[model samples]
Target: DIDVLASSEDAEKVMDHFSTLPTVVDVTGKGHTKTSVRLKGGIAVDLRVVSPEQYPYALHHFTGSKEHNTKMRHIAKSMGLKMNEYGLFSDEGNENIPCSSEEDLFKALGMTYIPPELREDMGEIEAALENKLPKLVESKDMLGIFHFHSHYSDGSNSIAELAEEVKRQGYRYMGMADHSRSAYYARGLKEEDILRQIEEIDELNSKYKDFHIFKGIESDILTDGSLDYSNDFLKNLDFVIASVHSQFRMDKESMTKRISTAMDNPHTTMLGHITGRLLLSRDGYEVDLDKILGKAAQKGTVLEINANPHRLDLDWRWVKKAKEMGIRIMINPDAHSLSEIAYTSFGIAMARKGWCEKKDVLNCLDIDAIKKFLHN
Candidate 1:
C-alpha cells in the first residue's frame, strides 16, 4: 500500500502507526522535502505539503484520472489556473510552489471531494462547475511512447523513415518492434533476414542524429509456447517482444502454457497484446489475463496496448490491473505504414483511459535506458 504525506508531523504519525504493523518491511521518504513514506509490507506512501493558497492546484495534480484531470483543467481554464502535473500555473508567470498536499489543493481548486478512481470525465466536468471535478492526467507530463512497427517486417517504411516521423511528432524515441519469423502472413523475417535488418538499422543510425533505433523484434510465440527462433538469435536482439499469432482457438490452459513458455525466455522483454482481442473487428482470443498479467509483472515484462484501431488488444480494464501490480506497459501503434506511425497518439490516448502515466510506460525511456533494460 502507498501513502502520501503532507509534513514531518504527518510522516511521524504514519511511522508511529507503521511501527505497529508486523508486516511492514521498509519506509522511504522521497521527493523534495523528504515528504514520501514507504511501508514495510512493500507498500509505499508519498506525503506532500501544499500551502493553503496553492491547495487547489496541488490536489488537482496528484488526484489524477486523465479524463477527470482533463475536465478539471477546463474548470481551471475558466478560473484562470493553468493546472498540470507539477503545479497550477498563474497567468502572471510567478515562481511555482509545487504544492505537495492533496486535500488542500482540492480546496484551492474550489471543488467538492472526489476520489482518484472517480475522476473519469463521466460527470466530473459538471460537478466541478458546482465546485467539484475529478482529477485527471495531463498531456504535457507524458514522456514518450514505447512499442511500434515499421517496414522492417510488415511495416511500411524503413527504420530511418519511422524514426523521422516519431521525431517530427516531438517524441524522444520509438521501439522498432518489427514482426518475428513465424508471421509469414505479414512477411516475417527469417534468421538471416533478421540479421540483415539489424545491419540496415545500424546504417540508419549512422545517418540520423536526432533519433535512435532499438534492435527489437516482434517475435511470434508459437502455439506450444516456444519462440520462432533459436536462443542464440533471440539474444542478439536489443529486445524481444513475444506474441501469439496463428491458432487463436485454444483452451485456457493451453493459452496459459503458451504465454508461460514465452515468459520463461530470458530474451522476452514484453508480452505483446495480451488478450489478442480486437476492439470491433475481431473478438480477442480467450486467455487468463489475470494470471498472464501477474506473471508478466513478476517477470519484469510489459503487456503491449496494441494501438492498432482494429486491434486494441489488452483492453483498458486489464491495464488497470497491471497498474495496481506495478506491471510495466508499452503502447504501440503496430504501425505497418509511415502514415500509421502517427498511431502512437491514438495509443497514448487509450493508455490514458486506463490511467497510465509516463512512469508506467516502458517506451518513455530514452535510447540508453532502453539499451540497459534490454541488455541487463
Candidate 2:
C-alpha cells in the first residue's frame, strides 16, 4: 500500500491520475479516499489519499514493524495524546499537532529520530530515548575491498580486469582472495599458479600509481581443522581468508572446534561466512557462534560479513556480539563478476543493522593502516 497526501481540491485529480496509469490493468475498488488496482503483473496496489497535515502520521504508521508502531502509540498514550494513521491529537479533543517529517514526529514525542532500518523494536526505541544510538557505518567509509575472486578460480574476470574495475569504483586497494587449492570445483590455484598470480599482481602494482592489489587467497578449511595449504605456502600470500566449503553436516561442537582450530593459525587473517547460510534457500550449518566469536577474539582473527545477497553469512544479528567482543569485521562482496562487486552495499546494510560504526569495519581503514593491521 502507498499513501499520498494532497490538498482537498487535488484529491480527486490524484485519484484520477492513478486510475489512468497504463500498467494498471484494472481498478478493483475506488472510493473518495481509497483506490485499489491490479497491475499487468498481477500485483495489487492500494493508494490512500489523505489531507496534507496527516502525511507524516500516516507514513510513520504504515512504514513500521508492528512492535515499533505499538511502542510509539503507547508512548503517545502515556503523554495524554492519541496517535493514529490520521494524526496525533490531544486526548481532550484538541487540534492535531503539526508533524512535517519523521524527525518532527520523533521530536514532538521527545525522542531522537530512529532510522527505518533500526525500527525492529530490538531496543532501538529505548536507545533513542537514552540518546545512545550509534552513528551507523556508510558506504563512503569503505576504502578498499578484501574478498573477491578472479578467473583463476570460479570468477568471470581476470586479475587485471577486476583491478581496473575496482579502481574505477574509487577504491584504493583490492584483495584478490581467489579460491585455494582444495576447492577443485572452483579451479582453485595450485602452488605454481599462485606464484605466477603474485608475479602478475606485482606487475599490475607497478602499472597503477595509486591503486594496490593485495595477493590474498580464500583457503579452504580441511575436515580435520587445518588449512588447505601448508604454512610455508600460506605465508607467501599478503593475507588469507579461511572458509568452509564442504562438511556442512558436522555436529555443532565439531564445527565450532573446526573453525576455532582455523582461527588458531597465525596465518588465518580472517574467517569467512561463519554460518554458511543461503537466504531463503539452504539453512546455515549449526555451530556455537558465541564460542567461535570468543575464540576469534582470543586469536585476534577478523570475521567476514559475506556481502553476496544469497549468503549474508555472519548474519546481522550477530554483528553486535562480534563488535562487543572487539572483533573487527570486513564487509566482503565475495564477488565473482564486475556487477556483483556492487553487492558491497548490501553488506554495509547488514553492518548498519548490527549498529556498526566506521571504526568497526576493516575496509574503512586506509591502505597504509590496512597494511599495518594485516602485517601485525
Candidate 3:
C-alpha cells in the first residue's frame, strides 16, 4: 500500500509494521519530512508531512519528474517563492499566506502550462510555449543490454573488459552475442571455439560475483532458411540472436522465407537488425516487415532495435506498428567497444520515438525472465 502521510506519528506506525514484515526492507529518509520505504515484495511507499499552507504545492512538486520539478522550481523562484518537497514558502516571508492548490501555485509563479509526459528534458519549457514537446526515454531507465560483440568476433574488446564496462555503466547485466560461424569474414566462432568461450565466460562469472554474462550468439540465417549452427549447438547457448549476414540480394519472397524458417525455431530467441538496413550507407534488405513481425510475435521471438548509428535498422518508424501488433523489442547497441555501449541510448531514443515503455523492451527483463524467454 502507498501511504502519503500527514504526520510523523502515522509514518512511524507504518514503518514499524513494515520493518517487521518478512522478506526485506529498504528505507530512504531524505530529511525530517521525506521518507521512502521499499517493502520486501517489491512495493514502494513514500510519506511526507507539511504545513497546511504548503501541502498541495509540495505534494505536486515532490511527485514530479526531475525535469518538471526543476523548471517549476525555477519559475517559482523567479516569482519570489521557494519550492521543495516539504513545502512552498514566500520569498518575502509571508508565512501566514494561503496557497491551497497546484494550479494556483503555478499561476502565482507566472509560468505557462506544462504536461507531465513531456517533462523529460526535451525542451519542455519552450515546447510548453509552442505546445510541441516530445516525450523521450532517458538513458537511465533501461535495465540491461541485449546484443554486444567482443574480441571473439571483429569487436575490439575482451569479454571481461566488456562486462566491466557495462557494470561501470550501471546496467544490471549484458548479453554478449559475437558473430556465429557463418560470419567467417569476422572470424566468427566454430562449435569448439564457442564451447571454449562459454567456459571462459563462466570463469569470468566466478571472478566477478555481482554481474552476469549471457552466452549468446549472433547466428547468421543462411540463404536457404537454415541457421549457421546445428540445433544442438544453438540449444546449448543462453540465447541466439539470428540475423541476415550474407545473401543480402534475395527477392522479397525468398528473403521472407529465409527469416520465416529461423523464426519458426524455438531456440532462436531474437531476430537481429530487422530489414538489415543501414541508415544512410547501404539500402536495407527487402523482406516484408508485416509478415516478419507477425510471425515473430506468434513464435515468441524478439526483434532487435540495432542501435549502431550506421544501422539503426527497424527504422523506429515501424516500431509503433510492431508494438501494436504485440511484438516485443530487444534494444541492442551491437557494441564492439567501450564507447559503443552508449549506443544503448540511441536505441532507447528510437524506442521512445516508437512509443515503447520499459516493459516493451525484452532486455529490461531480469536475468531469470530473460532465461525463461530463451528457454520457452
Candidate 4:
C-alpha cells in the first residue's frame, strides 16, 4: 500500500480528487481518516490524514518497518511515554510532546536520527542508542555504473550510442558487460567478437579525455561450475560478471557448489545475482547463501546486488551480512536500455537498506582505485 500525506482540511479534497483520477478503479472508506483506492493495474494505495501538528510522528510511524516501529514504541514505553502515529504522549495525562521533524521525534526518544532505509530493526535501534549508526551510501557516491548491455547482446543501443548517453548523464566511467557466447538467445559474444569490441572500446576511449569504457562480459556459469570462457580468454576483459542464466533447478548442495567454484576463480571479478529469482514470476534456485557468502569473504569476491527491479538479488539482508564479513558490494543496474541505467538509484536504495556505507560499496571507488581493483 502507498501512504499519501495530507492535512485534515485537505484530506477529503485529496481523496475526492484522487478517486476521480482515470487510473483509479475503486475507492473505499471515503470521508474517514484514511481512504483506500485500487488503481488500474491492481495497485493499492492509502491516503492518510496526518494532521499538520502530527505530521512528523505520522511519517515516522508509517514509513518504518513494523519491527522498527515496535521497537521504538517499546523504548518509549520504557521511558514512561506512549507513542503512536499521532505523537509521543505522557502516560499519566495523555499530554502530547511536540516534534517539529522526524529528527526531533528520534531525539525525544534519546536516539540518533535513523534513515528510512536502515529502519529494518536489525540492530539499527541499538546502534542509534549508542550513536553509532553508519552513514549509509547514497546515489551521489557512485562515480560509475556497471552491467550495461549494448545491441551486441540483447540490449537496445549500440556501444557508441550507449557510451555517449551514459557520459552525458555525468558518470565518469561506464562498464559494459554484454553476454558471453554461451547465451545463444542473446547472441552472446564469441572470442573474435570480444576482441573486436575491445578494439572498438580503444577507439572510443581516444575520443574523450574524462571518460573510459571498460570491456567486460557476463560469463555464464555452466552446470559443472566452470565459467563460459577459458581463463586465458576471460583475462582479456577489463572485468567479468559471472552469472547463472539457465539450469535453475539443481538441489541446494549442487547449486551452492556451482556458485562456490565460480567465486574461487580469480578471473571471476564479481558474482551476479546470487539467487536466480525473478521476483513475483519465479522462485530463486535452491542455493546455500551461507556457503556463497563465506566463499566470497574468503576470496574477496565482489558480490553483485543486481539492481533490476525484478531481481534485487544478493538481497539487502545478505548484502548486510556480506558487508559485515568485509565483502565488497557492486550495485549493478543490469541495464539493457538507456533508461535502465538510471536504475542505479534503486540499487542505492537496496544498498542503503542493507546498511552499506560509502566504503562498503565498489562503485564509490575513484577511477584509479577502480582500475587497480579491476586488474587485481
Instruction: Indicate which candidate wins on TM-score.
Output: 4
Model 2 alpha-carbon drift over 4 Å, by segment = 1-51
- What tens-digit string does per-residue lDDT give for candidate 4 at 1-376? 6778766666777677877899889986676677889888988888888678988999888889999999999999999999999999999999999999999999999999999888889999999999999999987889888898899889999888888888898888889999989999999999998899899999999998998899899999998889998998887889889999999999999999998888878799999988988899999999999888888888989999899999998899999999999999999999999889878888899999999999999999888889999997
Per-residue error for 117 in candidate 1, Å, reads: 9.8
What TM-score does candidate 4 get on C-alpha atoms? Answer: 0.98
lDDT tens digits, residues 1-376, model 2? 4444443446778888998899999999999987888888788888877777777887788777899999998999999998988888998986798888889998888899987778878888888888888899999999999888999999999998899999999999999999989999999989999999999999999988888999999999998889988998888888999999999999999998898898888899999998989998989998999899888888888999999999988898898789878899999999999999999999999999888999999999999999999988
Candidate 1, RMSD to the unseen true structure: 18.4
**lDDT (tens digit, per residue) of candidate 3 on 1-376:** 5757463345455555544556437775545555677777877776676666666666566556788788877866776777776566787874533556765655455544444433444455665556453344556667689688889888999998999889998887889899998899999998998899999999987876667888899999998878888887787788898999998999999999999999987678889988888866789888988899889878877888999989886777677778778889889999988999988878887787676767677867777787687667
Could you tell me every candidate's TM-score relative to the true structure? 0.65, 0.90, 0.65, 0.98
Candidate 3: residue 104 Cα off by (Å)? 13
- In order, candidate lDDTs are 0.70, 0.89, 0.77, 0.90
lDDT of 4: 0.90
lDDT for 281 in candidate 1 is 66
Q: In model 1, state the lDDT of residue 76.
A: 68
Clashing pairs in 3: none
Output the TM-score of candidate 3. Answer: 0.65
Error of 2 at 28 (Å): 7.3
